[model samples]
Target: MPSPCSSPRLLRHGPIFFAAFLSFFVSLGTLPAKAVEPDEVLQDQALEARARHISEGLRCLVCQNQSIEDSAAPLAKDLRLLVRERLKAGDTDQQIEDFVVARYGEFVLLKPRFEPHTLILWFATPVVFIVALLIVVLAYRRRSAAAQLPPLSKAEERRLKRLLEDR
Candidate 1:
């Protein structure tokens, strides 16, 4: 019979034990809590879900790091209602987001559009990195070339020898 400390038994039982433990631990947060308030969400579940998805991607103008949907500030509430109203009016999610961005500037959209002004936001970092790499490469090459200079003249070597011997 295999010893108690054998590898096969441990390997076979380890993952099963760990998985059960994780399932038990993770289930602590999986239970449903209090239901959503009637005043909180609009009548339409799908529309409200869409609005939430969009709003979660939008920054609240008055709140610290809170999305418009989560923020209770007047501006956030206004923006949330505006999103729902725009959805009811049949505006696509992108269209509603674009409307909000146009009104509030790119700061409203968590991920700004990659247009002319924001193109630099996309390209400038890479360009700077490439230029810096090129400069480093040139500097390294220059340093290496400087280190590879020809030996000193025979006269200079003789003078050094004489100075050292005389001293």
Candidate 2:
């Protein structure tokens, strides 16, 4: 017998919807970004390509989850404009990234800058796991050793039995 979760309508529509949703999501996931303002375009295709690449890696602080390329927020628009301006002015990609990172702190870059400060973010999980494992192992060893200890004295057992009987 089919379970309620596996009925015919659900099986048919469920998979159709799932496939449609997945395809829709995958297609849309490449940031439905707007083209640059006609005025902002550099005369060079390489510069435009470079601008797109850089913008895609910079988060729009105002839009939360969207990159500046995909965001329509005022701040995103401003940042995108700034990026184009910088690119047209002959700034290298690293220089543009560094300038934005400096202004926005290390948080603006989609890929964080690897340095002493960020080593903590990368290593925090391992450090926490190691500490917790040590604690668990110590606890297990304590319990095991306690279990292996000689049984309580006969007198102590008798006293415990008497107390339980009274209760």
Candidate 3:
């Protein structure tokens, strides 16, 4: 009997099955996992939408890389609730953000404000890159200059000739 691997149908459909399997995982990766529970949803659609927007911009302190909207941590849920409460209390989006920032400090923001304290955070990478580039350029210039030997003096030439003869 032919093995399953040797079946004509399996050979014909192998690539199709493989592609389907790959696409399933790819789609899963692209879909955001929402941690919002049904009870946490507000009856007011506008308020809920604003809360979701705010949650998307706030980082989960426990999951440092994930937005609170996508995080399942208890702290993330609390933040989501807080945003909704602030919205219900007639706070503007900016006011809600300010309140959260005041409570949690700038670290809770996914994108920090451009303040004097954060200037170094914003400029550090570019400054380091420019300094590294300058170092590389200077090193390359020095290497090229060193590679080109000065014209040999007459005495040096004679000495080299004598060494070559001895060799």
* True-vs-predicted CA distance for residue 137, candidate 1, Å: 1.5
Give the winner by TM-score: 2 or 3: 3
> Tens-digit lDDT track for model 2 on 4-112?
8889888878978899999998989775767456776667899888998999899989876778887778888788888888887889999999899889877888777
RMSD of each: 6.7, 6.0, 5.1
Which regions of candidate 1 fall more than 4 Å away from where they truly are? 1-45, 62-74, 158-167
Best by lDDT: 3
For model 2, the stretches where C-alpha displacement exceeds 4 angstroms are: 1-49, 64-66, 117-119
Clashes of 3: 0
lDDT of 3: 0.94
After TM-score superposition, the amount by which residue 101's alpha carbon in candidate 3 deviates from its true location, in angstroms, is: 1.8
- In order, the Cα lDDT scores of the candidates are 0.83, 0.85, 0.94
Model 2 clash pairs are none
Count of clashing residue pairs in every prediction: 0, 0, 0
Instruction: Provide the lowest-lDDT 10-residue window in model 1.
Output: 31-40
Give the number of the best model, judged by TM-score. Answer: 3
Give candidate 2's error at residue 144 in angstroms. 3.6
Ranking by lDDT: 3, 2, 1
Q: Give candidate 2's total backbone clashes.
A: 0
